[model samples]
Target chain A: MHIPNGFLDAKTIAVTSAASAGILTVSLKKTKAYLEDKQIPLISVVAAFVFAAQMLNFPIAAGTSGHFLGAVFAAILLGPWEAFLVMTLVLSIQCFVFQDGGLTALGANIFNMGVVGVFAGFLIYFFLRRLKIKLSISAFIASWASVVMAAGITALELAISGTTPLIQSLTAMVSFHCLIGLGEGFITVAALSVIFMARPDLLKEKAFSKKITGLVAGLLITAFFAALVLSPFASSLPDGLEKVAHNLGFISKEAPSNFSVISDYQFPWVKNKSLATSIAAGVGVLAVLAVGSGFFLVLRGREDGA
Target chain B: MGHSYFDRYRQVDSFFHRLDPRAKLLWMFFFILVVVLTPAQAYTAFLLYLLAVFVLIRLAKIPLKVVFKQSLIIVAMVLMVAFFSIFKGSLEQKLLLIFNVTAKAWLCLLASILLTASTPFELLLKGAQSLRVPQVLITLLSFTYRFLFLISEEVSRMQKARKLRDFGNSRLKHLKTIGHIAGNLFVRSYERGERVYQAMLLRAFKGEINTYSDLRFMQTDVGFILITTGIMLPIFIFSILFTTQY
Candidate 1:
């Protein structure tokens, strides 16, 4: 979703960057008062959790693995404003330290994943909540809608930039995301159920049905444990992007880089795809927990003291 | 909690870091413009652009390894896209065009990374608001930056709990459990938002956000913008004058 500089025309990137910067600035001022002592640590830890969850990718079809974006989850826990801040921070670290995203496209990436994903997802949840939708059902619908909307926004941006044809890009992004959304929707619902069981105190306005929680917990617990044990055996399927790229006659468009540190994750002993992914996941979870958690505590403590 | 990294170095004593964010924004804008406007066939120009970014990377004292590493995501995307372009034309021509795209993108990435790394997120937002960016957008972005990590941490605890109890399952069942975990996360977040909003209302019950931070343009800011623009103007002119048909 992060549109690197060269991928977009000069005019497009310029206008988009300006637009994103403007929106983000206004967002900061509007929410300044809400950023209090308690909220700071809470938001940071949640962001770290999302960062960790993103590492555990489930294989789709052929060999490609698609990880959770957690956009809707962020918006759901934190407001859209807080979600955006957290995402920007996460992406900043990812780009500067880990090289996960391109620097030039940070604004665009924020626009797509951060802005569109967080706000749009929350909006859906808001509408659904207002309609007297049940918390569990609303979670499902909100999470699904957010993922789909984000994917749509991403595809639209790509089309506008002439990266791919309009319909083709939209179809590719949306279709694959739809499948991915199913996974997202279910995950969101299950997580909410757990919270309902453990911290029912958090559900002040939204009523939690214990019966549903038990049912969901029983089902999801069984499923999650199964995944942890069988994670390495998940199918290696081509994800939404790869499938679309292949079908759109752009399969051969890829070129090799002159230099890349972690290109393809090809190592000496980690020849197995699932093993490599697992290793990556292990490193990611540890990093997010150790570094992310430690960083949050330190920063929050300083801000509170100041 | 990790709010300071974006602006950590902005407070550091450096000529580039102290420049007004608006001025820095313009500098980054033009740098990207020059890079993007270059034709995909302009191989030399692309190489030159990379060299220029590399020079800035050195001058700014940013870690090269970090910048390059952060760029892997874009690199992967570029490669993925380029893979599709392999059949577009001759293998050699396709490679050159892809390289052109990749190199230009890399330079632009470095430019923005340096900007954010050097500036504080707060000041960056302040700069944007001062520039008349919409209040809603800025507010939303600020919250996003401010609370993302906290939300992530919450989700982590929930996952940890799930892991502790679900110690035994098959592959298919494991995926189902993972799926359920995601679902639960969504529900928990939705409920959390309600509490957070209530907490906010209790604090003010106001529709508008108020902030206290002073931002002013300094001579160094002007010098910084001028220097960046002046250095890159020739490259833009040359690319325009010697435009070649791809």
Candidate 2:
């Protein structure tokens, strides 16, 4: 689920980076205003807890197990903002120290896991609660929904990065998630039940629920709709409810979109194959050298220039 | 406990280890960009990348046995992806694609390992802080690093305790026990946070946990950055001249 470096293209990296950064800045400010000083240490401790809890492997079937993700768990305990921050911390540490994810793809990982996963759990759980759904049941459903949403978004990113066809990746990713979500749902319900018994006061804390903003809601709906449109490609639906798959099937269909720009013999406008090859080689040389000079400029050229 | 886990070779002093953290970070970042931006079909370029990373690792005085063992993770991932790619292309074409992704990923991981292994966590964070990571994030990260080992130790202790009290083989009950353990840890960690905050407040810890500034972008840093960048042009030239089917 953690996207590695070189898996995503520059465009996908840029867009996801912007989106996650925007949401996080807003979250940092919002949480800061409400919790003041105490939330910082609390968020850090919970982040540590999530890190350690990830080591807790729950048995599923024979010889296979899944670790706790804790996005939804965090959202339920602390508000969505703090949940996002905690996830960001965990994912960032995973990327930097453990190298579990890629350095460049950190933003996409955060967006998929933190923003999409956390918000999905928060909104759905509260919405279910409003309808008088039982607390444990609402948590179960929300956790399942969050995992599924995260899997779908991950497939979307891979497809957009041209790593795989949308239909195939979506089908493979979502189908398995349908089962993984069950595990997540059961564990979340179990954990919440215990917490409810031990520290009911924690469950009752609505740290920051009022300002969910239209941007987040719209992003959720759009992604959910995208998953809906793409889910038909899977061919096996459990029926009744399958509407969040996306229609991002064009990059695969386009055939020569990203690769054409940097293909083995690219810059085709020159019209001669050998000439294009030479020109491409020349450009690579010039680009590399230019970057070299740029690094020198930033690292040393400043002193001389000044 | 995990302190010794990360960058086990940080105590070793070598050329790469002695370079400024900022320079090492920027050079590694640039190296990754070049490796990733190179087309997958550019096998020669990927070879050059592997060579560059190999030279840097050796310069850092880290043993190849350790590095190769760490790289098994990336290799395993590539094998899985390659297996799935069987549906996409012919055996030869699939091999090329697999080689492409594996080489790129392996090279990136090596460069990252070199950077982190050479620089201590504090200096690395200081370098990243200079690169625009927020102070709040830096503080949280340092605290997380400080407590991660303690918390992970706590988790193992609890696991040991649970194992000692093992009863039977009911799978659902097993799952519930794991969940209860996680829930208990969460409560304990939350309270621990309050206690830690009180301690910090007593010590007049405002908001930021600061790392001292000892990093200087020196002459050797500039040389290392440029020489590596200079290596890229020839890699592409060799790649274009020899490897391409043209």
DockQ of each: 0.13, 0.32
Instruction: Give a tens-digit lDDT track for model 1, residues B111-135.
Output: 8777777777667778888888665
Model 1: lDDT to the true structure:
0.58
lDDT (Cα, 0-100) at B189 in candidate 1: 52
The top-ranked prediction according to DockQ is 2
lDDT of 2 by residue, A13-116 (tens): 76677667766775675576544574567788899999999998766555766677889899999878789899999999888777777887889899888978
Candidate 1, residues A1-306: lDDT per residue as tens digits? 555566654433554465456546544643466554334434544554566567546556567656777776666655566677767666655553334555556676776677666666665676578799987787778777767766776655553343533445566677888877776777666666666676665444421122232223223322322342234223222233343554566544232221221123333232243335436434433443354335445545755897
Q: Using lDDT as the measure, which candidate wins?
A: 2
Tens-place lDDT per residue, model 2, B71-169, is 667765575566556444335555656666677777888888777777888788888888888888887887887778788989999999999996685
TM-score of each: 0.61, 0.83
Model 1 chain B weakest 10-residue run by lDDT: B1-10
Interface RMSD of structure candidate 1 (Å): 9.3
Categorize the docking of model 1. incorrect
